[model samples]
Target chain A: MPKPSPKRKMVRFRDRAKCRFCRENVTHIDYKDTQTLQKLVTTRGKMLSRKRSGNCAGHQREAARALKRARFLSLMPYIS
Target chain B: MPKLNLSRVYEAMFLVDSGDAASWDDLVKHIANILTRNGAEIVGITRWDERKLAYTVAKRKRGTYVLAFFDLKNGLAVVEIERDCSLSEKVLRTLLLKADHFSVADMRLQLGEDIRQDVAQRLMTERGETAAVVHAVVSKPTHTGGEPVLPEPSGDYEPRHERGRRSERY
Candidate 1:
């Protein structure tokens, strides 16, 4: 039998366990609060995915809705 | 009597040219007329903001936003109000939203509150500054003759002795 190749040891970094909104206990996401929304979007004006933004599924949905509304009012750009 | 519970609250934002905002009182009344004409009760109307738009609408570079809250019994009233806004020359854009989530008190807070001052203060605080530097610039000053005069240069005005050299060069 061929000798088993050496298993690479997996190294773990600092724990990123909690979503940002969950950690802060945010109940509502306001589109008028552009500062917070800007953090959740990429530089290109595209929304970051759940995994990238670390937002819970519920907050992510709310953020998406707010972003769309903001875009319609020209509060946020549709494309950068 | 018609059902009292049929009316629902709504939030609307109207975009108008900043130049035309000088007649906001008349504009607000016009908007109220439109809403009341369609059986909508006006809760409040306020100047929301005056700012540079991210994109121009109706060839207007600067826009003044008017925020209004109202209660409407029929959903079709929204369509009629939208039609009126589109037909009106004063209004550039209009956005109507069902605001069932907002309480009457919260709606009152939004009315007549301009957030620009708050934003400026927040930015100053974020920069580790305690006070705001407000410089009021008057572009034109009315002279005693009642004609507008160009404002004096802001900095110390040292008469330019070098201005005569251009004539010598000719």
Candidate 2:
């Protein structure tokens, strides 16, 4: 039997243990933090999902609803 | 005796005068103390800091923003909060939303690390670019194959790219 070529090693990776919302001490995430939340919010004014956002579970939940409430209050754009 | 259960969570965002930063902190603390005394669990409190408003409110050009998320035993607390906020001169505006199906687990899944990185990258890229247009195309449900019908523009102005095959039609 012909020798099989060596199988390529699959590289596995893990995400860093840091608050994605605040990588640096200076970065802040606020509901009125429209500039920051704007980056997280969808054009439709919905907060992006965590699976998509990579934010820790706690902050993601807070950020999502914050963005939504911000939109309803006209603090953020529903469609922009 | 009857068991008391609360099913609704609420998220509130309000604006305070930026000039009175100390008063703003005190106001938030007062609201929180009231809620806790009334059996409400404070879920999270985020200071949104200050920024320019999209439009003027109460003749003010700019205001400080604050967000408070909590769970109340019932909607009664919400009503009281709203009433108090309405009467407060320092509170420029306030909005409270009932979170029916709020789940932290689901939210975390939606904003995982990879996604945050992408958002960070997009923001950086967008900042480098000028006047980028964001196009939102909603897909229509298919009917028996003819040509896919596009929704008509509801506004007087339509983008040139969306006019589609104008020369061919002419």
Candidate 3:
């Protein structure tokens, strides 16, 4: 009898959570709104990736732009 | 090109020392004069906020922000205004952005009675016309609700349960 084929390891992928902006129907991400932006960044003031922040591709792009603007205005810190 | 000379809306934020807040009227007039001198039409002007800086800028710990909206035909006017602001002793920093997304009504709504005396009077007389126009333009959700409410640097974004998880991991 032929040897049984070795079992291959299965890779598990987590389902993506819904983006907060999409859930709230937010169209524009205001750089002045630091409260919302704070939630999207890490403690060290680095922006979180879409997977980690639960932002959709579109909102993630806007968030990145807004965050950079906020940093320039000194409305948000560049680093903690 | 003709398109380059076409009028466009712009939003500018001016940063000044909080100490000069008393002479806000003068600063606003000064800014208005600069825009007018550059052939820009004044649409609206408002005081955004006064707050402590995240980082020291121009050796100032606190600053006051003045927001202005205008229509300008010359694109070079923006460069000229920025140059003037930098040279002025009253202004510490400035940030200007294209504001085509906003409408005249939206801009007018931000105009306070304390702004330019003539503009304020004109708005008072044309209140009905302005209100009708406001309904036509899609209103923006107000983001200038004073300063940003900063939560504690710790334990705000993270949930209570998740807070302990970090310590446990270490």
Candidate 4:
């Protein structure tokens, strides 16, 4: 078997939580809060997925639905 | 009533008086119940209590925000939800939206992006460009195709030193 590269081993460390958004409580992920929801949604009115946002499963789900609701009500733009 | 497509997602935002949070909770539950009874999927519910509004709404300066996200069959649910919101004295405002174009897969892709900066930067860039274009147009008269003429330098024109001193006296 080929030797495992040190860079490959270090990739796991880089994946650890370094996102400032998640660290700071600035963006409150609330399903009912359109102002906050607008931050998570895309200009095309699509909700950003968990892999991209680094939000835990529970919060990601909440944010996604909130974005959808905000878009539906025209509080958030549905399409760019 | 026309049959609604079962796979559509819907989201709603509602504001109620801060004093009426308890009352609004029951109303929100009722909406969830109705959606459930009608075979809608209850995705999530969030209650944001005791927040100040950017501007006074319904003559109140503060209110509680409730957000609900669900998937339901399209039909009279939208109308029914609106009617309920209108009848509830506790509810100051309500907004309902549909997420027909989004899917579970799409949502998965957006989970960890820094959306706030992205949005703010985009808005700022757009505004900045517009301002720059407007400034350029205003500074150069529309009829002039050539470069703008520089005004002649004159001693009567106050230098920066005098301009600062003059404003200080006012």
Q: Write the per-residue lDDT of candidate 2 for residues B119-146, one digit (tens) a residue.
A: 2344335335322322211111224323
Which runs in model 2 stand beyond 4 Å of their true positions?
A1-72, A76-80, B1-4, B22-24, B105-170
Candidate number achieving the greatest TM-score relative to the actual structure: 3
Candidate 3 ranges beyond 4 A from true positions: A1-18, B1-5, B108-148, B152-170
Cα lDDT, model 4, residue A19:
43
Give the per-residue lDDT digits (tens) of candidate 1, residues B58-108: 777667778887778798779999999999988888889887655443554
Interface RMSD of each: 18.6, 14.6, 6.2, 22.7
Off by over 4 Å in 1: A1-18, A23-27, B1-5, B112-170
Off by over 4 Å in 4: A1-80, B1-5, B22-27, B34-39, B101-170
**Cα shift from native, residue B103, model 1 (Å):** 1.3
DockQ of all predictions against the true structure, Cα-based: 0.08, 0.06, 0.23, 0.02
Superior candidate under TM-score, 2 versus 4: 2
| Residue-wise C-alpha lDDT for candidate 3, range A1-80, written one tens digit per residue | 97654442111113444677887777777666677788887766777756556679999999999888878777778976
lDDT of 4 by residue, B44-68 (tens): 5555334555456778866665655
The candidate that achieves the highest lDDT relative to the unseen native structure: 3
How is the predicted docking of candidate 3 categorized under the CAPRI scheme? acceptable
lDDT of 2 by residue, A24-54 (tens): 5322244434555655644444455454455
TM-score of chain A of each: 0.78, 0.59, 0.78, 0.54
What is the C-alpha local distance difference test score of each model? 0.65, 0.53, 0.69, 0.50
Query: Can you give the TM-score per candidate against the true fold?
Result: 0.66, 0.44, 0.72, 0.39
Q: lDDT by residue for model 4 over A1-80, one digit each (tens)?
A: 99999897565234536443356543334333454454454433445545444566666665776666544433455555
